[model samples]
Target: MNALKINTFIGRQYDSNFPEVITDAVPITNPLAVDKAYNILEENEGDYLYGFVSLIYNDVVIFGEEQLTECLLDTWSTFSYLLESRYDGSKHHIIFLDNYPYINTTIQENGQYYEIQLDQYQCFLVPIEPFKKELKKEFFNFVEFCKNEKLWFSEESSYRGLLETYNEIKISK
Candidate 1:
């Protein structure tokens, strides 16, 4: 079993040496605000930030539906758009928490359609889901892939509930 352990830090400013992966976590209270601040810092540092851009992006991993929600909300500032966007079920996904139950459930239930996995996995689907046809295709493709692979994960109901609620939140435009 490749169970992962998570290290969580809560604050505005994040400074860590945790190997930029899922086991190491640094959840900023307000990441957008911090990002803006970091942009300023980068401007002051001249070309130095560019050198660290990969590391910087890798360091901040978004896990769970809530984290994704916060991210989508911050970016789109609306629920309907987020749901519609996710309809295609395609986005770059990176799981940051080690042994997070909700994430494990997502992986267990919805891993086949795209490159959904533990850390820094790529998904082929695009983020544009407004109609039933698109969603049905993407969703069924994932389901068929899972069946063919015969892959399954251990599930926790509470975690599943949280994810379902998170999905509802996204569509609750």
Candidate 2:
């Protein structure tokens, strides 16, 4: 297999030179998709943590291999619309997913092409409020830490930094 670097799914051209962490981490399961992030979201339902986000280039995700069964079953229209509206002349767009956050990418090996899926929940670097209400302690702490630490990014940083921080927090915990 070609050595695709295993790091946060920042935009295609992103290199992690800034402070970031990962949260709501989990292991991937689905053979056809990355279900790790979804597993965490499901387990944390009624709690504070939520789903993962993918840093996409245009409509195509740059992470790993997976079937868009969930996306098609769930947010096909929303994603399509997002592509149509937000894709523009830009070659990339970061998708902020509150739920159903998973991806699959293709690989070549042994004279054949294959797909490997990973749970993207391991991709998020911060805890997010599950509901649109006052922030919880963990959420507040993570946000405050981001602010004080100057971890926030202006252009493509939000997606990458938040996802990176999520991983850091997960490892520390």
Tens digits of per-residue lDDT, candidate 1, 11-82, equal: 112224444532222233234333443443344342111100011112333233233211211112121222
Model 2 vs truth, CA RMSD: 18.2
Model 2 Cα lDDT, one tens digit per residue, 1-173: 22222212111121134336333322122221234333433443412222222323223454432222222112222222222323332222223333245322212121122122234333221111111011122333334433454432334223344444445544544
Give the number of the best model, judged by TM-score. 1
Candidate 1's TM-score: 0.22
After superposition, which runs of candidate 2 have C-alpha atoms over 4 Å from their true positions? Answer: 1-101, 104-135, 159-173
lDDT of 2 at 31: 28
TM-score of each: 0.22, 0.19
How many clashes does the backbone of model 1 have? 0
Q: Cα RMSD to native, each candidate?
A: 17.3, 18.2
How much does candidate 2 score in TM-score?
A: 0.19
